[model samples]
Target: MKLKKNITLGLFISASVTALAWQQSGKPESFAVNGNLSGFNDSIVYLTYGTFDDTKIDSAKVTDGKFTFKGRVEEPVQGMLFSRDYKLRLDLFVDKGAVEVRGATDNLKVAGSAIVNDYALFNQEIMANRKWVNNIFTEAWNAKQSGDTARARLLEADGNKWYAYEYEIRKNYIRQHPSSPISARELLMYVNNKTLDECRPMYEALDAKVKASLQGQELTRRMELLSKIKTGNKALSFAQTAVDGQTITLNTYKGKYVLLEFWASWCGPCRAENPNLRKQMDIFGSKGFNVLGVSLDKTRDPWIKAIEKDGLTWTQVSDLKGWNNEIAVAYGVKAVPANFLIDPSGTIIAQDLRGEALNQKLKEIFK
Candidate 1:
């Protein structure tokens, strides 16, 4: 589910880049979307263009089973056509030419630009594979609920197998279509799933034009950030206000072994791990070790309450920006309950330690 959202956002970013580039070049690019929507007449259809962060929306009223959107963009952009009733939605690539979308309102088709067509096909295949995997997962869950352990296990295995198959299909597509924007988008979508080593070759193989796009630049930046945070690298320096309204800096813990922990109140796994973390702090606090907790919560009240409830008495800080936490982003944290174990010299020695693993690492260090 997270992967699906990430892919959609990546595609939006790619299309937004094209629009922005055209805007900056002061060139006029025109687009026409002729949509023949069956079973939907005298209704409104919306055409939205831009990135996930920023967007421009336009609406056209369907008359006589058809609606047309004619506009000029700076460059080719990604857009969505959906009904006012929120029942029908189709992703589109708005390019400098005539585009045709005609089919049942629920099963729309796109035809126009080469990149757009490629992206549509890629999305169609991925969706089909995902649907298959999701069906297996549903069956597995139902079996587990019914106390059929053996059947559940078998179904779970089948789901995993299908998931792996989908992953390979995506990887192969990226490898084979390095010149397509869809390839670049797929690479960006899989960054968190694939390692930097696995992604570099595919990224480098991309066409120069694709590599220079907006999403490409963002992916490159993410790769660089990820590279800097490997196990052997120095911990990135940061400063933020603690929950108590005092300034705290990463270097303040220079002479102590520090566990730089990223978590959030909204994260169930993180909350569940709190008791174990508290135990570690109790054993390690007086032994020249400390924890610097960075909360990715969106507000202060819930964060403070969780800290108090969990009995986490170590240094705590947050910008309260949820997933956009500055320090977490710098550390390449895509998920909560993440941490870096840094030595007194500020070098990261371990990462993502949890439960018994954290305690064992601490024992080894302080024994």
Candidate 2:
């Protein structure tokens, strides 16, 4: 009982320290970005709103290889450091103060401990893991470019190794920073990935008084998505109006092979793949193969026009909600040209088929 009490007390102290650090926020902050530039003098930096949007350079600087950012950022804004079209890296989390980076950082080495407040120690762990992920991403990209397909596959087996790693870090961080919404959300996101059987006691830990107190807006949505995916409970069957004004549910084509395609009207890759898809459709459309396109678009005119322009005569459907569509949330669709090919019985057999490989698959299945 004494050891248990000591553990509980220690946790309380850690949570209190985190809360105090974050609560005393709302002060002006600055960041000093320093690094080496081979020869480039003028570099523009930008913050991307979403993954697939135009880059807007809110801050401009001339680099003698080192630059400083001295400004105040509002809470919940994740800091992104960039140089021209080279790479955009998630540098640090700004709640209401200045955090600094003191070295050259691509997407991989962005999380170092140069300029951070004394309390959280987020910069250290973030940097360590960022380096690991950067190594993985670089290795994967290089292998793929070098035509080393097997090597790339091994390096990039899971696209989400960082998320899972963050879970463990956040779990330990939370014991010392219970009042931190950021840490709490991070923990919940990781827990949500686990089985309900695994997370049951963790949820139960916050059963009554604590659950209501932990309010995380962004964290809440992420947690919900993770929960849904873990459970495999279909929120609603994929339903949309066909181009011919007919209703279609993804479930309607359940017994046959189906590909759930998330794409957009303005996407060049999706347009380029249309011809290959058309050929595949011609061969396999009658052989228990179908495509259900979910357009990540806001307007109907361009969406319809693109379908006609690409000669995509498949059953295209969307709620016309663009990125905010609930279906995108339900399936965890982050980027465009994403696809999942379900087998005849509706299990995900393959994904992201394009180019000659797609043609090869059609030949194998249809022959």
Candidate 3:
């Protein structure tokens, strides 16, 4: 489940992130990953690492429980190694040195760099939660689709609780290891998970070297793009056809408090927040409060169905371009369930508020 080979080039499917060992770094002529598997019947080993633009994968045939990879890396990069069978995976940093891996398929020992160890530890918790939540959510969704509301609710409750727990774990780790490159990677994984003010200081605290790393540079770009839309700035205006075939423009609601929500039909978290939006809409709909939904959904059927099913009795808009929707792209919304609360004057007051937070914000504003 961890290793997914990209079909295009059979490139290494990112194990996403993994934990503990040692960190080393240098400028050797090349990097080597020599692995030893005790009883893995897999005939090949693979290494995967690269940037967003370039994903590279190398394979080595397993011979007598041993495997080796030889390559050159410009910088110490985060990567993963796994068997051709994908039953075993080790998240580690591949630097310009000889990294040795040994042990069974399940428990792997990686030694090469300090960054790799710390990186693994950070991702071990994060990636584990990602998988856990995703798996449970799939079951819950199946239950919901099969008309099993009770089971679905129970599963969703557990998933939500675990998600919060894992998020807390991430916060603690980043705060404790502000200097770790792993922290940078964690933040970059989902910028919408954090507030600009809260995450900015943490980003600033990263070591100079990390800020220059590929992850760091990308994080920097994401943060910079997000900063332009921070609270207190004027909300950007856009227009799209609402779900009901009515054209909706942000400026048309200029004199009302509006929740500019970026969501998708497929996002469970987004769907879960719809009830809260509805509740707030009822309380404030006549009090100059409104919700403008921008969905990152490409299909009309599921998009309309989700809106009607969720009882979102408010204006919703989309370009049917999914992530490529110009409105969503302009807002730099990588994460769904994202929103910006705008005051009557068209200035964003808060962002990504949900549940009790959204309730409280409307309460304070209306009062």
lDDT of 1 by residue, 226-295 (tens): 7899788899999999988999988899888999999998899998998888898788889998988999
Specify the highest-lDDT model's number: 1
Q: Which stretches in model 3 have alpha-carbon errors above 4 Å?
A: 1-35, 38-48, 52-74, 80-89, 96-100, 113-183, 190-195, 205-209, 244-247
Which candidate model has the greater lDDT, 1 or 2? 1
lDDT of 3 by residue, 82-122 (tens): 76667888788776678888888766777766665555545
RMSD of 2: 9.8
Error of 2 at 365 (Å): 13
TM-scores of the candidates in the order shown: 0.74, 0.54, 0.65
How much lDDT does candidate 2 score? 0.57
Better of 2 and 3 by lDDT: 3
When 2 and 3 are scored with TM-score, the better candidate is: 3
